[model samples]
Each structure stands twice: as structure tokens, then as C-alpha cells.
Target: MAFSTPRVRAVRHALTAGLLAVAAGLSGMAQAQSSTPIKLLVGFPAGAGTDAIARMLGEKLKDELGTPIVVENRAGAGGQIAAQALKAAPADGHTLFLTHDHSISILPQVVKNPGFNPSNDFVPVAGFATFANVLAVSGATPAKTIDEYVKWVKTQRDGKDTIGVPAPGSIPEFLVKMIGDKYKLDLQAAPYRGSAPMTADMLGNQISAGIASVPDFIENHKAGKVRIVAVIGAKRQPLLPTIPTFSELGFPNLDDYPYYGVFAPVGTPQPVIDRFGTALQKVLAMPDIKQKLTTLGLNVAYEPQGQFAGRVRTYTQSWERIIQASGFVPK
Candidate 1:
């Protein structure tokens, strides 16, 4: 038995085409595995402390991991949008969220359905730093001390005041309510998308005071544009040594510090998580890196994934009690 010339040629052509197709598929898979840039997602706009740190680490991580890293800002809804984005991303370790306590620890507790849960939807990659939030007043505000500010709010502002916050339902908002109750003044929170805008309002006297992390206000405070009157922590921060801690000011319950960290979508391989954790440790260990982050107001430190996750759990539980005591019903 023999095949016709046309049939034989057709069979050869089919075999050649099949081999070429398989090679192309393999090449595509290799490129997908090797060349796609890892995205470091931030829940706030660029120029805020979180975004600044993420970009800094992303630059160094490119060298450490020998791959390109892209910092993507998906800033909105108190980081809910970014958290949801992380949940929707593939669990291949290519996407990670860089956020602070507001998003990971507090948001889910406050919002009825935040679209994702930290324990269920994401895995901690590492913890980098802890920081205290500060209460800062505008340069034009006559008050300097927390006592003086309270007095001014009573006497100068007719017992009512508005303080800008970086986000609604954020720690700062709760602080606004607590401060009002403590001092017996009508204080309300004017929430902004991020600290940059909130600071801008404070500068223009659009809002007389604001509460945000030290890094957000440190530069301005040093410039004599914003006045940091009170800080929240067990001890006074080195950057604002003169400022009194809330504990010193008689509000001991608001002293727990918040953290900055990274997270990957759940189900990401542990080895990939470890690789990132190791790179982050190296980045945090550099003297220059530590100095820069310290200058930016982060108490630069590194915790591996397990320790980081535990910290998140503890912080979340603590805030849960605080929120309940405040009578805050989740929205």
C-alpha cells in the first residue's frame, strides 16, 4: 500500500504545522512565566507615605529579584478598591498590596462588606514598619498645645470645629469623635481621598486641623506650615520630640501604633512569598534605606510572614474592641 504524492505532502505539512504551533505555545508560556512585571499595588495615590515607600522598595527589589516591578496606585474607598483588586488578581505572586493598618486592620471591621477579608483573601508577605498618627493644626491656627486647641475650639470657634481626615471611617475619624467627647466640643471629620489633599486643605486653612501619620505631616511641620500638637504612641516619636503623645495628654487608650506591610493574594506559593520576604529584609537592612525611611517617620523594622500575620491579627482584634467601645456600627 502506498499513499498519493498530494496526501503524503499534506501529512508532512500537518506535522510541521503542529510542531510549530506547540513551539509557539511553549514560548508564550515561558514569556508569561519569566518576563511579566510584578505589580506592587498601593491603595492610595502617589506621594503619600505608603506610595513613597512602595516605590522605594520596588526600585531596590528590581535589583534584588532581578525582575522589573511596577508600582500601581489604585487609591480609593479607604483602600477597599485596591484590596478588591488584589483579590481579583491571579495568585501567582506577581501582584502584592502595600498598605497600612487602615486598609488591612480597620476597613473590614468598619465596612459591612469590604469585598475581601485579609485572612481569607490575602496572605501577609512581610511587615516593614510601625508608625504613629499625629494631630496637626494649620499654621494660621492660634492654638499650639492640645489644651490651647481645645480652648480655641470652644471660645474662638463657638464650640464647633472640623478636622480633615485622610479617609472616612479611618482611625483619624474615630479620633475626631473621641477628641470631641473627651474635650466636650463639637468636632467633625472632613474626609479626603488621601493625606496630600487633606494637608493641602490644612495649609490653606480650609480645615484648621488634621490627623495623619507623621510622614504625611512631618515635612510640613518642620517647614512651619503645619503644627503637630499631639502624637499617638506609647512614647514620643523622635521626629517630633517636642510633641506630646496622646497618652501624655491623658488619652492612653489611643496609643497603639499602626504598621506598614505587604500582602499577596491567597494561595500564592510559600516559596515565592519567602523570596519576597527575603528581598524586603535585605532592603530594610541597608543603612541608607533605613535612614531614609526613618527620616520619613517609619520606625524601620522587618517581620517575616508568620510574625507579620500574627501582628495583623492582634492589631485587628485590638481595634475591634476599640471600635465596639466607640459604638461604631459598621456601614
Candidate 2:
């Protein structure tokens, strides 16, 4: 137990060096986690609803994660482009795709190859909101409800009554056919590139009515330019309580609401996914964030990772059955 002073000093020096090395390692890990800016990808154009939501979430998430957040717009093939980009991005927790059910659940059933299967290629980080498609007409139309709109269509002596939908083979487009079958009307479904153009035509009276998300028509409906006759979901939206739901209107088959969720590519570390999910849950719970999404006609609902992934699976299966029943052939 007797040691020279120099030997004791050498032992102290070695212990100090090991502690410094450990500290340096810890510092590097922290720096790596905080230095990189997370890239939040949106599969729609800049002004689209999905893009707007993504930017809003990104703004809040940046503060929560203590890192810069960049929203990248890929914008094509009904969100297939952005989904594919996320699949190819690094699995370092630095990239995510914010999208609605169309890209994750519906597109896979309708497109021959969406480049990535949502359930297979991606892991759900969190579910932020849910929305319902609405059946709305221009203010010029004398229809106060779906029943009235159907009756009014019968009275029109015009060539044919057309209902604009955001895109072909989308839920809105398919609902038009479902409505026609239910009412025995010969209404035509006109597919527009997106809700913006569809809304434009609806505002101009070029189209008798339109089928789009409630947010797509909320502003115009409030402005007295368009009237939302019916919504597709189990219950009336809180933002538009006056508008009845498909179930309330007796169209029970159309009562399905699609969700908006954040997803990371498969093979990402579990810690990263969990961290992002936690941050997203916090972001969604923020009062202002909830208000913004609520005003946009979206229900601010948050589902954690496991629950969100399960929801994606259930939704995909449900959409598969619906799309099959609708006789939609993949393009």
C-alpha cells in the first residue's frame, strides 16, 4: 500500500484523462443531436393545406427540439414524391414526412406503384389531426342542405350538374358517385387538379357544387361565397356544427374521417422516433397550434407512436376495402 509520489501523480493524471475523454464523447453526442436541422417534407405544393400545416408544425417543433426545422415541398403524384423522398432520406432522425391519409392510405390502393408502402416503408411518429370531406355548393345555388341540393339539381334545366372534386380517384370524387347512387341522380363528378382550382371554379359558378375538405371551403363558406351542405364523417364538425354529417344526413357509408400524421422512414432508431413523437405531441397540445388547426377545420387529435402506427394500418385496410368496392382501377 506504499506508493511513491510520482506514481500517485501518474495514476491521478490517467484518471483525469479518462474523465476528459468521457466528457468529450458526451459533448460530441449532444452536438450531433442538436446541430442538424430536421427536414420536414411536404408532398404538396407550397400553398396547399398540407404544406401550410407542415410549416406551422415545423415552426413549433423547432422551438421544442431546440434545432432549426426546414419544410421541404416535394409536391407531386398525390404525395408519392414526398413519401419516396422520405424513404430515401437518412435514418438519423433528421427527416420526416407530414401527410394526410390520401398519400398514406388511399394512394397505395389507387396508384400502381406509389414507390413506397406506408405500413412497410415508414413508421408513424404521431397523428396530429383528422378532417372530413364536405359536400358544398356555391352561394348562388338555392340549396341549404344535401336533400335540398339533390332536389335543386333535379330542377336545373342545365346540360348537366357537375360537382368538382380535388382529384380523380380521391375520396371526394368517389363520394360523388356514391351520392349519385344513393339519390338516383345523374350528377357528374368533375376532377380538378387540387382543392384550390376546384374552389376557384365553385366560387365562379362554373360548377354547381364541390366536394372537398371542410377547411378547403371554410373561408369561402364564411364569406358567403359557398355553402357547405353536408360533411362526410360520423359527427358534425365543431367548426361547422350547422352542417350535418353523412351519418346525421343518413349516408352512413360515407362517415369516415381521414387523419394527418407524421412519419419517418423505416429503420430509423427507436429513440429518434420516440423523441420526435413526444415533441410533436407537445406541439399539437399548444393552445395556439390547436386553435390554428381547429380554425382550418381539423380536429387536433394526437396519437402516440404505437397507437398512430396501428391507426395507419387500420385506415389502410379500410381504404382498401372502400376503393375496391368503388371499382377504382389502379392507374
Candidate 3:
């Protein structure tokens, strides 16, 4: 109470310096925590569907955060490379995996030792896209529909004709077997690394038919190189109004359309997860994103963490049955 003016000024200066130090430390911590650019790792090569979607979202994420977003293509092994990379990432939310059901749902069923656990090693970020696969035949083939395709295969298979699948135990392979079994075709199913390679074979006459996402063949099929035998969703894809759904052809249960989603490495903080989800929701709502996906035959859908987790669990159960029913085993 009786301090001199100089003493009081010295105390005030010390207090001010301490406050500034604390403020600076907190600001630096904030920047370190979540303000940096993020890497969106895609498990497919450029021009692939997953890569395209990741780039679209990465651009929006960059805009929304004022940070750069890089989409690194880590192709091969049906996403095992990307999945394993995600498994080893820092889980700091600055790196994420953008993948389809194959890596998340089918791989566990396909590989005996996949090297990563999707359920325990990753946190669901968002599920924002779904692709309805179709059974397609080469234009050189005489099939116009799934029924026609099966019947024609019986006519011309002549002991051996191939139905190209992205890979055995992949979602596309499952669809191929389902339709083949349903129609009693028993045609050979040939597996490839990804849809791109499979489509190459289908178009080059190396394979007579293929089970692939609608987007994969929409252009070539329209141009007369390939044709959709049947779509695997319950209803017709809005993008391809002319393509008939499996249900429309009396297999309503072929409604299991495949989806794509993002997941951060396990242990990423909850706040970071929230930031990603919010930015992604805005991206998904963009008019251009919706239009582009639809035009490519992907139906846009978004689910936040909780719903996406539920879907992961729900589809886990469903695909186990499908894989078993389809007589597929990891080998």
C-alpha cells in the first residue's frame, strides 16, 4: 500500500511481460494443433474415382481452412498400401485416408492378414459418397441386359469366357458372382488390381464382361465399347436414367450400393475430427461437387462420425454374409 511509483511501474512491466509470454505460447500451440495443411491420401491412381473425389474435397478443404491440401496417390493391393500408411501416420488429423468400401469393408474379408485394423486403428471421419456397381458386357458381346448377357454367355461361352472383376473378394467381384450365380451363368470371374485395369481388359476384348462401378463405364458404354448389363442398386441411378436397376429386373435385394469414406489414423484428437467433418460437409453440399459425382454415376451421401461408424458396423455384418454366400475365401 505504501510502495513508491518506480516500484509500482516495475511490477506492472513484469506482469505485462508474463502475460505476453503466456499469450504467445498459447498462440503457438494453437497453430501447431490444427492450423497446418493436411494430406489427403488416396488409395488409387489419378483419374480413378476415389482420387477424383479426394481432389474435389481437398480443394474445398484448402479453401475452407486457408491451407494447402495435397492428395497423395498410394495405389495397389486394393488399398493395402494406403491403409498401411494410414496405420503408421501420426494420427494428428493432418493426414487422412480417403477410400472406398473395398479397403474398409471388403479387404478384411479378402486378406488373411491385412496388416491394419480399420475398426480399431482408424477413426471414421465421414462417409460422403456411394457408387452403384453394374454388371457390364463388352459391346462385342451380344448381351443387352443381365438376363440377355447370361443367356448369351450360355450360347457363346464355348467352355471359356471371362467376366472381369476388380479383384476376387472385392465389392465388384462380389456383384459379379451374385449376378452370375443368380442367373446360373457360372462364367469365369477374372480379378484385377483395380477398376481401371479391369475396364482396359473389358474394352480390349481380353474379357467379355465386367462388374464395376457405374461411373467406370458410363462414358465407354455410351460410346458403344461397353454396355451395362444391370445396375446393383435398388433404384435407377439418377445420373444414368436409362440404366435399369437390378431390382427393376426383379432382384430388389441387389440394393447394396458401395460407399466411400474418410478415416483419420487412430488417436487423432476429437476436435480435429470435428473440424474435418464440418469442412467436408460444406464440400459435399457444393452444387458442382454433387453434379460432378452424379454425372459420374456416384450418388452423393454424407454421414458424420456416429452414423458412419454405424454404417461400418452394419455393412461389416452384411458383407460377411455376402462373401460367404458368394463362396469367397481369402486365399
Candidate 4:
């Protein structure tokens, strides 16, 4: 182990040179990543809940990322259009899709040619939150609980009791079917273009009941314009603790909550993925971000890349079975 002074100096010089080269490479990579503006694509209209969440995250992420983040809405086909656009975008870590479970997990099963497979076309950066669908009735309806609502529905003058759902083949629509089957009630799901119109119809008494996300009905529920009879989740939502969950109400099949996450194109670099995911975790951990999302009736659940990707796979499988069992025919 005896080495000459000259040999030791040579070894030290080589080590220093290698370390400097590595540091320079890393600096170059960081500069490249921050050189361009990040585009966060929302797969819904401007005023939709998903769009709001995307914009909120973009605002906070821009500060953490030290780069401009622009939110673009490409609304159509239940997020299929935006998913396809993300797939076509360059894998430079400059484009991301801020979407919910509908576009990522449910659409592939319901749409014959959705143009992109979430599990295959994109990589999960991070999952921000999860939200439950709610079953609510108009204030005019003389019912408060699910049991009472079932009775009132049976007594409707029309032979078919209609429940308005935000969209066709959505979780809310499937829940309407599951609830009807569980209680042996004659119920029909009336699919609307979106939650806003469905909620409007509910307020106008055009429909006896409506099924949408808690946020879709929270304000109206609080104002007494609508009554949230039950929420679709494992337990009662913290924002609406008074409303019972479907599991507690003897319907465990409706207890699944959908997720919201960020994704990038398939070939995005690992370093970029890590950087963005770390920034997202930091943003999700902020007190104000958590509070804001919670106030919107979302569970501030943050899952990193590995766990989020696994969740996406499991959710996809679950939805596949649920969609098939619901007898939904792809369009």
C-alpha cells in the first residue's frame, strides 16, 4: 500500500477533475430544465373544477420551480383531447397534464380510441388529491337521508325517477346505477354536459336528485338549496362531516374516490421528473395549499412518483371492472 508522493498527487488531481466535470454537467442540466416555460394543460373547460385546481397548482409551482407555468385548457371528450395533446408534445419536461382520474383511468375503459394510454403514454409526476362524488337532492324534495330519498323517488308521478349526472360514463353515473340496484329502485341517470348545468337543473327541480363531486354541491348544500344525502367514499368527508358516506349507509361499492395528478410525456427525463415531483410535494405540503384544496372538498393526499404510478395502475384496473360491471357501452 506504499505509494510515491507523485502517484498520490496524480490520483488526487484525477479525482478533482472528475468531480468538477460532474458538477458542470449537473449545472448544465438544471439550466436546460429551467430555460423554458412549463405548460400545464387542463383537460377541461376554463371554469371547471379541474381547471381551477390546475391553475392553483401552477401558481404555487411557478414559485417553487423558478419558472413560468402556464395553464392551457383543451376541453373535450372527458379529457381525451388534452391527453392526446400531451402525448404529442415534446418530452422536454416543459409540458404537463394536470388531470383527474376520469382522463387517466376511466376514459381508456369507456372510449374505444382515447388516442393515448395514461399508463403507457405518460409518467406520473405526483398525485395532489382525491375527491368523492356526492348524491344530493333539491331543496324542494321532501327527503333528507338516502332512505327517505328512495321512498320519495318511488312516489314520483313519472314512472321513471331521474337522477342527473355530470357526464355519461362518469363515476357519478355508475353510482346512480349501483344505488338503484342496491335499493331495488327504478332510477334513471340523465347525463348532462357538465356539473354546472346538472346542478342548475337540480336547483330548478328539473331533476329529483343529482350525483356529482362534493365540491359540485357543497356550497348549495350549505345554503340549503340542495341536501347532500350521502357521499361516495370510505368515510364521511371532513368538509362535510354531517353527510354520511355510502359505506356507512350499507353501500360499500360506491366508496371509491377519484384522484388528481400530474403527468408528462413518456420520454421525459428522470431528472426533470424528479425535479417537478419534488416541487409538487413541496407545494402540496404548504399549509395554504392544503387548506385551499380541502376547502374545495378535496382530500389533500400527496403521493410521490412510485406510489402515484402504482395508484394509477390499481385505479385503472378497478375502474375497468366497475365500468364493465355497470354495462356501459363505449362510444
Candidate 5:
């Protein structure tokens, strides 16, 4: 059925107006995204290791993404605060969370309700590095090796067998329990607000030992203030070549390493994820940045979205089995 000439003209004009309006709306959205600063959330205090990494990445990412990057710290409950914040943010790619494995992979399984589900609330942007955790004995202790440390615990402290952990229900705390079970000692985990105080107590001999990331103890270990007896990884770490891995020492199941990655709110457009991830890939590839991160005890390896997601799944599953085997009911 042919319309009148006036009706046809009216339809053509309406279609043109609709197309122009849609184009204008898209252009406005593009302009807003280009001008808006991206907020990078970290669930740790300023000056913390995770905070440091976030700042470093933010510093370089601004140049690559062509927009200012702002790091926001929401310190509490072992990254639960920041994870919740990320969950609550709009899924418009303006907000991201930069964290290690604990927040995304472990916390939810341990906490009864952490207020955020990584798989449901966030999308993996990119993974920049992997790191190992170590068992470091305070300088006050005479033990330099894992065996010697066990002996010291069994003999030196008549009744005290406590290891300081950065946070309660953390991986280090679980490791403390595992070590106790293995050695048949009454080891207790003394939780601290963060690694700084935990290391201070270790330095002051208030705690016989502590378990934390390699970056947490590397400087002190190099200064002879603490002795790293064991690390958790498949093989020896390059930074501390002489330190034996738990796997090398006897525990083959403790070979998985934790990772550091960036995540955006779920439902972020694919172009946004791809752009941010591509920028991250370039940032991680810089020789100077790689050197700096390696110096901080990180094994720099850039994995894009798919590989990073797989890494997160594998690491999460490994720890899930370990946690379940430990008979730890989430609380």
C-alpha cells in the first residue's frame, strides 16, 4: 500500500531525526567516557603493597588509556570493603578493582557473606603478575631452616607456638594451622591489621614467626632481620633462590601461586574491557616496569582476559580444595 506523498515525507523526516538523535546520544556517551577519570579501587591502606602496585599501574595507565586514573582505597575486612564497593559501582567501565588472589578468590569462600561474588559482580580485565607467600621467622629465633624452626617451636617456647598472620581467616592463618597439623604442634594464629604490624611484632620477637607475601618479607629478609624458611610455589623463587618451596620441602599440594589482576564491574562493554586490557598489556610489557615489579618480588607475566579468568578459576579451585580438606567451615 503506497502512502500519500506527505505521509512518505513525514516518515523520511522522522527516520532522519531518530538517526540523528541516536548519533548525538552516542557521541555524548563517548565524550563523557573520554573525559571521566577511571577510579581504581584497592582494598588496603595507602602504602600497603597492593596500594603500591595500584598506584604504579595507575601512573602508567593514564598515558595508555588517555584518561586520568584515580586509585581509591577502601581498607577493611581483607578487601571485602573494596569488593563491595566494586559491586555497588555502575557497570559502565569507569570503576575497577586492583587486587590479588585473596580478595577475589579466597575471601568469599571463607567469609559467610562477603557481599560480593567475583564471578557474578566483576569481569576479569587482565592479570599482571604472580607472587609467592613465605614463612619467615623473626631474627630473635635461632632457626634458619624449616626443620630448625620446628625444633625451636617444639623446644624453645615451652608453651608458646604462635605465628602472626596479617588478617584472620587469611591464607597465612590457614597455612599456620596446616604447619601446626603437620608438625603436631599447638600452633596458633595471631591476627594483625596488616603485614606492617605483623612484621614489627616479628622483629620485636613478640611473635616467633609469620607467614606473608614475599614482598612483605623480602626487605627484612635481605637485611637479616627475618629468615624466610619456606615459600609456597612449584619451584624456588628467583628473588630468594636459596629458600626452599613447601613443595620442594615435602608438601607437593602447596604449589599454586597467587596472582594480581584488575577487574571491572560486570556488564562493562566489550570495547571498554578490550581497551583497558590492551593498555594493561602494554604497561606490563615495559622493561622498566617489569624490572620494578620483579624487584618488588612479583613474577611479571601479563595474561589477557581469557587466560586471566582461567588462572583465577584454577587458583580458586586449588585453594577451595585446600580449605575444604582443612575442615574449615565458612564463618
Candidate 6:
């Protein structure tokens, strides 16, 4: 195996140099990650709550990761489109998906043969924050608390119990179903394209009650146009201290609420995922960002990559039962 020929020696030297050059280039790129812009793909329209959070996190992630982060809206199918897009993209860490439980967990349970598999096709990067789903009654409604609302719902005529939820299989819809079942209340569930439409209908008295994420109605509730009777959380949101959560109402099993987080495509290097998660956790710890998210009534939930991945698995299983229990069908 000893090659003394000049030609063999020259070939070996060229191969070693080529490998060194490649290694050096990779190291230089990692050092210059600040100059490369990262993409954050959201599965909702611009101006939506998820989009807003994405923008906020992007602003902070850009500062921490030293890379300019850009948010791209790929809206449709309760975030399935964005999830699908992530699955189709290369497993590079450059493209990231900032989505919630709906896109990753709920949608797949309802849809038949969804193109993307959340747990298998993606890796959880960081979990940022969580907001409760507030049970809001339109101004025209004559009830304020869950007890009163339950009584009112029972009194409604067969067709008068229309409750406007964001979508048929969304988290909000599932909440309404869970509570309605617990209280033995009759409700006619109605679906909307998004929270904006449902909020509008609630104001117009088209739907007696609406269940949406607290961020969607926080402003209107503050203005007194809509009232938050109950929030689905372990405790009241700090901004809405007076509003009692379902657990406070004695529904201990209904305490934990939905969460949102960032995910990278599968096969992404563990180092990149760790770096991204660390930078995001730091971003969540910033005082200014914390104040801003708190103003939107969201609690900081900066779970690291491992724990966040574990929660995703638990949430997926829990909601599989809830979705099937609700009998929600995509088509």
C-alpha cells in the first residue's frame, strides 16, 4: 500500500487541500451567518395573530441570531399549506415554520391524508408563548359568566344556539365543544374562515357567542364591545385579571390551553436547531418583547427544544381524542 510514485503523492496532496478548503468555507459561512437572511413561513394571512407573533419573534431572532429574518405568509387550510411547504423544502435550517397546534396537530387529525406529517417531517426548535382561548359573548348577548351563558344556551330555541368558532376543527371550536359537553348545553356550531370574520359576526349579533384566541378579541374586549366570560387556561391572563379561567370555574381537566412554536424541516442539523432554539429563548427573555407579548395577553412559554418536542407529542395525542370526540370532518 506504500506508493512512492510522484503522481500518487501529488494526487493525495490535492485531495487533502480540497478537503481543507471545503472545511474552511463552511467555517467562514458559519461565522458570517449574520449576513444571511432566514425565512419564517407562517400558515396564515398577513395581519393575523400568528403573523404578528412571527414578526415580533423575527425582529428579536434577527438580533440574536445575527441573521436578518424575513416572514413569509403562506396562508390556507388552518396552516396546513405552510406545513406542507415546509415538508417540500430542503432540510436546511434557513427556512423555518412558526406555527401553532392547529397546523401541526389538529389539522392532520381532521383532514384526510394531509400531505405533511408534522412530528415526522419537522423538528421542534423553540416554543415562544401561549394565549388562552377566550369565550366571548357579543355585546348583544345578555349573559356574562359561564354559568349564565350555559343557562342561556339551554334556553335558546333549537336554531338559536349558533356559536361562531374560527373553523370547524380549530382549537377554538374544540374548546366550545368540550365545554358544551361538560355543561350539557346545546349549541349549534358555526364555522368561519378566521377569527376576524367571527369577531365581526359576534359584534353584529349574528352569533350569540364566539370562541377565539384571546389575542383576537383582547382589544375589542378592552373597548367593551365584547365580553370575555371565560378563558381556557389554568389561570386568568395577567392583562385580564378579572376574567376567570375554566379551571377556576371547577373544570380542572380543561385547564391547559393551546400553544405555538417554531419548527424546522426534518434532517436539519441538531447544531442548527440548538442554536436557533437558544437564540429564540434569549429573544423571549428580552424585557421589551415580554412586555409586548404580555400586552397581547400571551404568557411567555419559552420551552427548550427537548421539552418542547415532548409537549408536542403529548398535545398531539390529547387533541387526537378531542378532535375525534368532536366529530369534526375536514370536508
Judging by TM-score against the true structure, name the best candidate.
Answer: 5
Q: Candidate 4 lDDT, tens digit per residue, 25-52? A: 5743763556578999998889888888
**Candidate 3, pairs of clashing residues:** none
Candidate 2 segments exceeding 4 Å error? 1-32, 157-159
RMSD (CA, Å), each prediction: 9.0, 7.3, 7.4, 5.4, 4.7, 4.7
Q: Model 1: number of clashes?
A: 0
- Candidate 5, residue 41: how far the Cα is off, in Å: 0.1
lDDT score for residue 143 of model 4? 94
What's the TM-score of each model vs. the native?
A: 0.89, 0.88, 0.86, 0.89, 0.91, 0.87
Per-candidate clash tally: 0, 0, 0, 0, 0, 0
Candidate 5, residues 149-168, lDDT tens digits: the string is: 98887788763588999988
Candidate 3 residue lDDT tens string, 1-331: 5766988899999999988767655543453455566888888889987888789878887887666788999998888899999999987777899988889888988899999998889999889878888888886687787667776777877534578888677876666656656677676778888889989988888788888888888989779899886787777877677878888877635676688889999987666677778878898899988888778888888899999888888877778887787667786
lDDT of 6 by residue, 20-127 (tens): 767655643573464667889999889988899899989988878788899999988788888989998877678899987788878888888779888789889888
* Candidate 1 local lDDT, residue 48: 72
Candidate 5 TM-score versus the reference: 0.91
C-alpha displacement of 205 in model 5, angstroms? 1.5
Q: Which candidate is the best by lDDT?
A: 5
* Candidate 4: 10-residue stretch with minimal lDDT: 24-33
**Candidates by lDDT, descending order:** 5, 1, 4, 2, 6, 3
lDDT of 4 at 25: 57
- Clashes in model 4: which pairs? none
lDDT of 4 at 87: 98
